[model samples]
Target: MYMLRKFRKVFSLIILTTMMSLGITAPGYAAMLGTDDILAGDNLQQQRDYVKELLNRDEVQNQLADMGVDPLEAEQRVDAMTEQEIQTLSSQLEELPAGASALGLLAFVLVVLLITDLLNLTNVYNI
Candidate 1:
C-alpha cells in the first residue's frame, strides 16, 4: 500500500512538472458580451431565421423547383450567401405579399389549364 501510494504521488508530480514546463494553460471561461455585440448577434440570428422561414413556404419551394433549382439546394445556398444578400432577400420577402395572393395564382393556373386542355396540349379533367 505504501509503495502504491508513493508511486501515485510520483506520477502526479511528474505530470504537474511536465505541464508547467510545457506552459500548458487552462482554458479560459467565456467573457460576457457588450450590449452592441449582443444586439448584433440577435439581429444576425433573426435575419438567418427569417430567410429560412421564407424558403420554407410552399409557394417559394414550388417556384424554385419550377426554375430547375432544388429547394434544399436553394436553402443551403442561402446559408453560404453574404449577410447583405440575406438582408436583401429578407427585406424582399417582407415587402412581397404572403404566398403572392394564393387565390389569384390558383385561379390563373386553372385558367391556363383550361386553355391548354382546349388546345389539346393536355387532356386533364376531360375538358
Candidate 2:
C-alpha cells in the first residue's frame, strides 16, 4: 500500500512537471461548432449512403416497380447522380413526415376498409 501510494505521488508530480514545462493551459472559453462547420464536416459518401439506404426500403422499391422502374436500375441511377443530387434527396427525405405518404395513406384506408368488412361493421363493400 505504501509503495502504491508513493508511485501515485511520483506519477502525479511527473504529470504536473510535464504540464508546467510544456506551458499547457486550459482554454479560457469552450469551442463552439457553427452550422457551416457542422455541415462541412459531413462527407459526400455519407450522404450517398443515406440516400442509398432510403432507396433500398421495401416501400420505395415497390413504388419504383409500380412506376415501371427496375429496383436495380434505380440503384444504378442513384449512383449516377451527382453529390449535389444525393444531398438534395437525402435532405428532402429527412424533411418528410414518417408514414405520411400518399401510398401509406392508401394502404391504411384499404386495411381499415377490409377489417370493417370482415367484422360486418360496415356494408361499404357488401362483402
Candidate 3:
C-alpha cells in the first residue's frame, strides 16, 4: 500500500511538471475587438457587393462593352482587389455626382473646346 501511494505521488508530480512546462511553452492570447475591427469585415463584404451590383447594371454593362472591357473580367478584378483598394473605390463612388444632365455635359465640352481654341491647340473655332 505504501509503494502504491509513492508511485501515485510520483505520477502526479510528473503530470504537474509536464503541464507547467506546456503552459510556459505554449501560451494563449485573447483580445477584445473594437467596433471598427469587427465591422470592417462586414464593410468589405458590403463594398464588394456594391461593386458587383454596379457591374451588373445594364447601363454599366453597356458602358463596359463600349470601352472594350468585359464585365465579367471587371468583376473578377474587383474580387481580386485588396481591402484597401476596395475601400478607396467605394469612397470614390460615394463622392461621385449622383447624376449629370446632358446639358451640363454639353456645356463642359464647349468650355473645353473654347479653352483649347484660345490656346491655339486646335482651330476648332475661328476666333
For each candidate in the order shown, give its overall lDDT on alpha carbons: 0.65, 0.64, 0.67
Off by over 4 Å in 2: 1-42, 101-127
Q: How many residue pairs clash in each candidate?
A: 0, 0, 0
* Candidate maximizing lDDT: 3
- Cα lDDT tens digits for candidate 3, 28-125: 79999999998989999999887677667776677666655566766776686679867866666665566632223223334544665697764445
> Relative to the unseen true structure, what is the C-alpha lDDT of residue 30 in candidate 2, on a scale of 0 to 100?
78
Each model's Cα RMSD: 12.5, 17.1, 13.4
What lDDT is obtained when candidate 3 is compared to the true structure? 0.67
**Lowest summed lDDT over 10 consecutive residues: which window, candidate 2?**
104-113
List the candidates ranked by TM-score, beginning with the highest: 1, 3, 2
Q: For candidate 2, write residues 7-123 as lDDT tens digits.
A: 999999999999898996676987899988777647667877776676677886787667555667556655765666667666666666777543542343345445655877544
The digit string of per-residue lDDT tens for model 1 on 3-119 reads: 999999999999999988899668889988899998977887798787777667787568656755566765665576567756765665566566574333333334544565687
